[model samples]
Target: MSSFPDYYALLGVTQSATTEEIRQAYKKESLRTHPDRLTKASSAEKKRATEKFQAVADAYYVLSDPTRRSEYDVLYASQPRRSQDPNASSNFFSQFANMFAGAAGGSGAGAGQPGTPPAGQRPDAEGVFSDVFEELLRPEVERRVSWWAYLGAVCGAGVGFIIANIPGLMLGAVAGNRLGAIRDAKGKSVAAVFNQLGGNQKAEILRALAMKVLGSAF
Candidate 1:
């Protein structure tokens, strides 16, 4: 990889670009690099597209947040440009599959080590699900369990108790609460909620989504 990635350059923005400018750049880069746009291309081409797409996303994930952008600006100034590492391109898609595991509150394991998923294997969907919904929505959108969720959980637990006893009751409650939360969140503005979230929280969501998408592509 280039020494420290130039988040601004990656998104085709200047260091002084506003958050809106960075967001617009991200959308444009995402559209251009999204793997779906390369449907008819060779496997290699598609892989390259996916990597570029994820990189663009990574850049935005860092730049869009005020705190992260500030920290990145510090690093950006001190880090000198260097020649690209040929090996960096080989595993561009694998880092998220591994890095986010720990960063997003997962079982501890670094990239390329034991317990990490191989390139083509799917990352932990449960982890990604939790990161997207729980991390992104909890504080910014809503944290309390809604009436719908409570009702669903109660009903689900009752059904489970009738069908399978203690184990089913526990599983049903968890499933019911999840369904209820989804119902409550259906009308919330995700964009507005995202804007209210902190930098690390946003990074958790972005890395989770990136891992899921890139893992699927491979």
Candidate 2:
């Protein structure tokens, strides 16, 4: 069963990001893990970088297209992901129609639908999420890491590479300490994330988590 990718999350941009912002973010992010940067990585790591690069590219594509972006917002944002069935990808038009029905009095929007939430008591955006998604799961967002992580890594790599340039005992130390630490940490984080998806349901959540992560990364 096919699942929709969370486009916004992939670009590390927000749903509210403008075209300019999206382009800037893609440009900035694409530079860091570019396959070329994986000069010292094993072939496997390079391949992984290549795939992530593609996901980033795909995110930029859909967001850059106005029509697709609108449809994506309507389908992805308007539709609640947790409908209980892991494999269910609801029909876009059907959800849109449901949204319309809700916009109207929701009395089945003129049918004898018993519960017409009163006009004055109209629910807020939060309620909108409740009505659309079964469980209304707000993404569990953790802290936004400081820019220092990237900066520090860049600084360390530069200093280490320069230090490793000088042959002899110092070079050996840089190779063992600096380069090794970076190699280990990058591999660990990357491996932890791309670890196999267990069951279908877990895969679905992980797929969703990937989007959320990709969004944050950008």
Q: Which candidate achieves the best lDDT against the true structure?
A: 1
User: Number of clashing pairs, model 2?
Assistant: 4
Q: State the local distance difference test value for candidate 1.
A: 0.54
lDDT of 2 by residue, 1-218 (tens): 23455657665778899987776565545444345444457889977765565455444444554644665577676544423121222222223323433333322211112122333221221122122221212231111112334455555556656765544344455445555445434543222222222334333443354344354322
Candidate 1 residue lDDT tens string, 1-218: 34556667777888888877876676555645655444458999977766666566556554555654565577568767721232342333343234323233222222232222443343332222233234334543354326678988998899888999999998998899889878767865554454445555554544444454344322
- Root-mean-square deviation of candidate 2: 18.8
Q: Candidate 2: what lDDT?
A: 0.42
Weakest 10 consecutive residues of candidate 2 by summed lDDT: 136-145
Whole-model Cα lDDT of every candidate shown, in order: 0.54, 0.42
Cα-based lDDT at residue 33, candidate 2: 36
Q: How far is 180's C-alpha from truth in model 2 (Å)?
A: 43
Predicted structure 1: clash tally: 0
Flag regions of model 1 displaced more than 4 Å. Answer: 82-218
